[model samples]
Target: MTAATSVVAGETLPSSMRASVLTGALKISMDERAVPTPALHQVLVHVSKVGVCGSDIHYYREGRVGPFVVDAPLVLGHELSGRIVAVGEGVDTSRIGERVAVEPQKPCRLCSQCKAGRYNLCPFMEFYATPPIDGAFCEYVVIESDFAHAVPDAVSDEAAALIEPLSVGIAASRKARIVPGSRVLIAGAGPIGVIATQAARAFGAAEVIVSDPVAERRAMAMRFGATSTIDPMTEDSRPLKVDAFVDACGIPRAIVSGLESLRGAGVAVLVGTGFDEVSMPIPTIMNNELVVTSVFRYTDTWPLGAHLVASGQVDLDSLVTSRFDLDTVEDALNADKNPDNLKTIVEAK
Candidate 1:
């Protein structure tokens, strides 16, 4: 219930809306904020659901992720689904009332990276939930109209929100060049690992092996698409002779082992966040002529991600294990602490 005025999408616009804000480490509070208006080429969306990401939990537990600090009352949520209620100048009015998955990133179009179709590397990117940028843990959010990717009726709101993470998996798969009959090694059975496994399969990998210390996560990986699972504690990975290695777990030991597991000329895609600097086995990488890369954020991925979910190539809804509303966002942020929980979502309504 908020003050209503302009009507769009068969619903009145609100003068103000509720937002879950993070004031400091482990501190969240509900705050009333004025609804924002869309700028040129932007769209105002009535937020429906927001997926709680590992990075969100990182910001919740710590005041910052690396250099991005929470210095003010910052709204925290990036993976989200919503309905477009209003369009800014230069946007088509027909977009209103369309269900969409927000890409949550606005990179400067003038940068060299953006010009080269690698906007994820744009230094001027304004990604949601990052410091100085308010995210979508609110009733309404304004994003570039192009970033508000419409979804098919077959895609649920929860699945739409999950497109964000699935895009990361796609980015990782592309980086590793997972191809037909490719044997892939994925370290970690976390959400990223599970999604990466599916992405690898979709990209035509014949053998997908996931390594995790947790038994349940390993099972979860198998359920999704992993051809096999490895208990990093007891099992060895080098024998797999994988063509590519994707490290979704940032653990140093796992990374070292994953690198060693790769066959000669294999590619290693590092998708997990870890210490700023870590020593690597340079000799092995040099001798094998292996290529190593990292994913910063995804670019030009939402459309394909939505298509994969709609076509049943990827399963996003099954990842959800918990749901909460704006008021209980604190509990949502803490959901990762539970071993049984795979993914948590927050309803803006």
Candidate 2:
């Protein structure tokens, strides 16, 4: 084997590999590209599974999400699980072959948010799959070693990929300060909402209610531990009984409806990303003295999420409604637009 082809026990090998490139809006092409070598604190990972996220589908269709516009070709995917194929110089080789769920956000540790242990809000974060930061929808990805958390053998690769989204739910639960016997209402029974339902239950919420326009998703939410499912299109003024609410739809309508369901002095946590400038019922929020907060990504929750899935406390497998190979990534993303499907995954083979 050539020196370039050979990899040291821990050090990253030579550059270049294959990846799915987003050449333009609604266009994806498979292309061979240079693999990245890991830096001093990084490791090269052989990606095994990537969860098809809503953001990925949005980027595939529009080539941009919010302010992050894609002017050049970029690979897209964030929820990922992989094995450590190689590590960087001065790094420990003991991690080689270890399975892990990668934390896609790389925050600057010196930032105020980082110091405050709220790294998810770090302004200088370079999150994977976001515009300008090519993500792990490829055969290999090199990331900081600390950002990858080791997964137990009990966690399947599918479940490992879900750790990313699960972490988001966990973070949201923490922000809401969920407690036993608290009535929690979750809007949008998508992956995040479904997972949040399960997380809220685990956190001791007495009753967990979910709302979604999609019949399939609302039904799936019940299977995943939601105490009840509310279809906003059909159910009116019914959600107003919950003590707390979580807005996962990113739609203005859902936000308004979820707030309407909250009791006085209740909390509402917004956990979804949509187009900018979503209007809310500010007067109602003021009248109820509701505490409104938003969570961006996650912070220090990967290990907890891993534990939840590995221990079988949260059934991550049920959330995966479909899977596709790398070659069929486009089709998989397209299928995600269908309301019938809950979560889609892409397997690297």
Candidate 3:
């Protein structure tokens, strides 16, 4: 416990906290690090749960995702839920016990993108789990009070952690402008794809078709709310016409196929983080007049994500296939290797 005069939370603060650090690719170890103190308008939270994301796995398996390389010891995790144990100056002391979903991005408030309400595109973004930025793969972390969104009683800690991915789905849906009766096609059955499938319905899409080669994932997508599923390995998507297409698979073939599936003047929202670069046919772009775009992390999406889970419109529980403690972080990161697995969580507490 901390010194007598340093008591911040209801319980005595610990001098040190356990962390799972990645020294390099395929290398990780548990280490003890000093607990951090919150700055002004920040809160020291005890991380309760963290969802293993594909980006975390990429860092674990490959040392880097595109240009973001992990050259030093780094903690890899972003999707997180926690309880406020301490509040810093200018923060209300009453928030010491609030349960919250942590938004891992802190964009410079003065950037033009932030001023435009698109902080997700801020060039000065300090994001968690991205090289040089230590994320919440530990017991304690400090976050801006505004970014520590409170979750209602209806939202479970695990569900709260999944809110990060849910935000991506929400962002994609919003970017697609999925209006009532719009026909939308999603090109992946992974976590984001599955979440996007549910999001498509929430946005009032009349027909939400999910395309994946895996029959199992296709079935899972149906359970999540996809009106139809196509095995790109066997079925053809070229004949299908849709108002919007969201590429969550990131597979070149799937993306090109999704592009071919859209009708004239449709929207193509690319959320998949597969290839660093991809080429689209100039003729296809001209003929279809597709408005292609992509979304970064997210902004102001936590409350809506929480509402979807609380109201039972989105099912977060169905996505969890396994759980791990802080010590077994490696297992959590490698969970994507198993096809049967959908989401793996690291329960910090």
Cα TM-score per model: 0.97, 0.94, 0.97
CA lDDT of each candidate? 0.91, 0.85, 0.90
Q: After superposition, how far is residue 187 of candidate 1 from its true place, in Å?
A: 0.3
- Candidate 3 C-alpha lDDT tens digits along 1-349: 2212233444678889999999988999999999988887888889999999989999999999878999999998999999888878888877878899999988899988999999998998999999899998999988898999999999999999999999999999999989999999999999999999998898899999999989999999999999999998889998998999999988889888888888999889999999877888668878879888888778899989999999999999879999999999998888788899998999998
RMSD of every candidate to native, in Å, equals 2.4, 2.7, 2.1
Candidate 1 has what TM-score?
A: 0.97
Poorest 10 consecutive residues of model 1 by lDDT?
1-10
TM-score of 3: 0.97
* Model 1: colliding residue pairs: none
Off by over 4 Å in 1: 1-9
TM-score of 2: 0.94
State in Å the error of residue 182, model 3. 1.3
Clashes of 3: 0
Identify the runs in model 3 with alpha carbons over 4 angstroms from their true place: 1-9
Select the stronger candidate by lDDT from 2 and 3.
Answer: 3
